[model samples]
Target: MKTREYTFFGGIHPRSYKELSNKYPIEEYLPKSQVIIPLQQHIGAPCTPLVKVNDYVKVGQKIGEANGFVSAPVHSSVSGKVVAIEDRPSSSGKLVKSIVIESDGEFNYDDNIKPNEDINNLKPEEIRYIVREAGIVGMGGATFPTMVKLNPPSDKKIDIVILNGAECEPYLTADHRLMLEKPVDIVHGLLAIMKALGASKGYVGIEDNKQDAIKEIRKACKEYEGVEVAVLKTKYPQGSEKHIIKAITGREVPSGKIPAEIGVVVDNVGTAFAIAEAIKYGKPLIERVVTVTGEGIMTPKNLRVKIGTPFRELIEYCGGFKGTPGKVISGGPMMGIAQYSIDVPVIKGTSGILVLPEDMIALKNPKPCIKCARCVDACPMNLLPLFISAYSLKNDFDKCKEYHAVDCIECGSCSYVCPSKRPLVESIRLAKGEILRKGRK
Candidate 1:
């Protein structure tokens, strides 16, 4: 096994409260009553609903069709009748058009789901078509459609394909548990991705903290040529695609550009597993593994959950809240979206459900920046967050753009390390959104 540690510059080491759920094996979770599935789970254009209210749908049936090439279709996770198709609260903190289905307890599968052609024999175009039809997206929080990533534009040569197993975000271990239990699938998925992109090299980049996962993945990839395991240092935001690419391949993705521009393509290990399942079993992305954890949770666990399962069901399955919950995050504490209610359903990008106790929540009081430059030092992108935040708060977006605020990855390192407790990331996020909006105009 390779013990060498690889890393990128500038990242914080927060308390990775993984012990709350890491030890527990992934338990299968089935919703007994209902499921609320949002059509706009993936990034880019939202999907259009194909089934109407009162329509009976079978599990793995395509209920929502992709609106454009950049979008992904949505599948029904349970055999049930659509009770409602209206705007509902989503994990992204937006009221998205969602389809609510009441389970019939039958759990019937779609007839089209079956094993496909062998991976070695399938062509690159065939692989992309299967992935697109499967509705797979980046499971590590960035919900970009997987097929769009696999089909890069011509002239942008992709030499390496890296599978992100870092799971660097605190309190999230969905990817970690996946690596431990489904190493073979992950490897096969990587191989499939490499073949789809016609890339020469493939790597599974995992953090050193997950030793067992590393061992299992290394063992799985031992026979596969041009594939190896790259151990990453345990650091915050190390799982970021650009940072992981840098750590594994030493290729820096330029600002305002993607990994494809640097001759690399990165996909999360969970995405890889999904790809393997999609190509091998002809399965659509209807279910995923999610980490339901935090101090507020009574019995933290990693759960194999259906895509449309509500947060309330998962929380109740985990023994519900222990005490008064201060906050409920959809992904991880660092980069996850703070949810307004537990009524939201788990989407494609929902990696974890983090419920923070009242005591664990931080106060939002702002203080003057002491010019500490700690945020600057902690930023993995090596950008000056302090100046950008300062300008953003003042609504000076021109100044924010001058400082390259668009380059901010919104990893939350600035806000975490700020001793003054300033909302650095929050302001920078606003600036980035406005900057992009103006650029489009």
Candidate 2:
């Protein structure tokens, strides 16, 4: 199999535990009886309701349109009758207008849905438009609009596109399983992205833990030139664009700059496959593979779940928590949001569902930092988390920015390795929020 290697900087070594989902192949879950799709699934302005109560809708039909340039459209995930259109709680813990469809069990699709032209003959603009219309976003959990990323400004020259397959977060194997099963589609999508951006080359960055995925991608890359596969040393936050770019090209995305500004752009592995499907099979971002795992889970499998499936239903599909799961996380432990209830609907950013037993989930009280600097060493971004968190606690927005609060990816590496259990990421997130709010003012 084709193979290459690259280097990256400081990162933490977390217990993987990916074997729980990695051992089992991906399973396609049937559409549940009810689907609650939120209008604000993407990163931008939330979509306005396109339908009222009692509207009959089919699969692959648009239920909500992009509210602005930074936003994305939402589509019906299953064939059903719209029973209600009202405000519902989303995974972000915000109330959003959601279209609740009670499945008729037919799972039918719209007549307008069909494959597009061969990608080779399609224009670059068409490629970007198809991506936008397909409702594709960063499936690695960023949920940023795919078309916007693909359509970078002409002033900024992009040379290399790095496809992220690292799946660095522990207990999540969605990208890992996807790489194993859909290597060709991943390559096709990568090539399409390269064409869209007029990029000279592309590389798939996968962690060494996924040997099977590495092997599969390697085999797929042989036929294509300029497209390469690089195996990275498995590490937390390695999947970060900066880290991936550093590993692949030895280039640093300058402080407070976009990767495109550094002649590079990175896309997630799942995003790549989704692009391929959008262009080839005429599908939107209605469904995705999610890793359902944790010690409290009965069956840990990679499931191709529909978007807007309630967290409760997805958990039940995986056999739910074994005994009494005290906590449910929307993603990996390092960067996931804890849920008080499973009423939230899965969105494009929902990568993993983690359930923890009561005893294991109970967190410890934070103690004063001993100035050990373990967090600084563990931080991939090289920020002073201790100071930033301290400043945030004191509501000092200027001090927080001085410590580069915005650079924090919220990866949770610092907190995971912290001796004081200081909630470094959470505190920094609050600081970043305040800083952003002030900037808007």
Candidate 3:
């Protein structure tokens, strides 16, 4: 384990609130009634449904086929009958075409899911094929297709692969518990990724707050030739791809470009664990560990939940809400999306479900900017958030674009630190969307 702690510039350290559920062992959660699987869980193209209404689907069976090169497949998390194929509300608050399955109570595995050859014998192409077939995506909530990330363009020579175990978001301990319990599997997954990308070096970047996790992962990396655990300062958005890459390898990903441009590939710790399972046990990315925590939750927990399971069921399994929920976010308080309904199903990107109590929620009105330059100082991307937000509020999107509003990672650090309670990230998000839309046109 590297003793020196690494970090990037411009970030805030919010109360992690990990004590709520960090100590809990992961519990398996199975939805009894229904599992709603969405067609588009990744960043690129939405998938096309492979199974029609009333079709019998088995666990680990691919039900949604990738529609494009940048897309990922979707699989059934339960053995059941497809009762409905309709538009449903996803965690992103968008209406997505989904397949709803009624469980038959028998979790039958698909015959196509069988263990492949040893990791040492598997070729790079074979590894990529298996990852795509298993429908693995970036589990850090980005939901980018893992296969696409692993198979970067031949011109870009990837030499470093990093697994993000930072889990920097507040109220999320799923990744932490995963690191402690399945460190060996995560390391194996890293090895598989390194081989696939032909990267010479691999590192699992974990925040110093998670000492046990670092120790466990370090132990797992001991025998591996080019794998090590890099300790990071516990800061908000430390888990961001660019920041983690910078922290671990001192490589700064250029604005408007990806880590692959700098010859590096970063993946979530959960994504690695899923890859290990897919390669070793022939399991699809049908399930993941989720941290259900908040002061509003009656009983906080870290659960191994199947994809397509409704958020309501998970909350109920964790003893439901302690009081009226002021808000229920999908991932974490910072980067997570505010869910309009708990009816949303857990998707490939779902990390943590945060339930904030009504009393804990503060409804504050925005005041005039005090010009403290706090927002600019807090922005990790080195962009002026206040100016971008002001221009966005004025509908001057061109001005926003000129300020590099599209480069903002929307980490909510500025919003968190602002005394005026300004909607910094929200306005910047609007600006980014408009800028991108105009570019597309």
By lDDT, the best candidate is 3
lDDT of 2: 0.88
Q: Report, for every candidate in turn, its global Cα lDDT versus the true structure.
A: 0.94, 0.88, 0.94
RMSD in angstroms, all models? 1.0, 1.5, 1.0
Clash counts for all predictions: 0, 0, 0
Off by over 4 Å in 3: none
Badly placed stretches (over 4 Å) of model 1 are none
lDDT of 3 at 227: 98
341 Cα displacement, candidate 2 (Å): 1.5
Q: Report how far residue 8 has shifted in candidate 2, in Å.
A: 2.2
RMSD of 1: 1.0
Ranked by lDDT, top first: 3, 1, 2
lDDT comparing candidate 3 with the true structure:
0.94
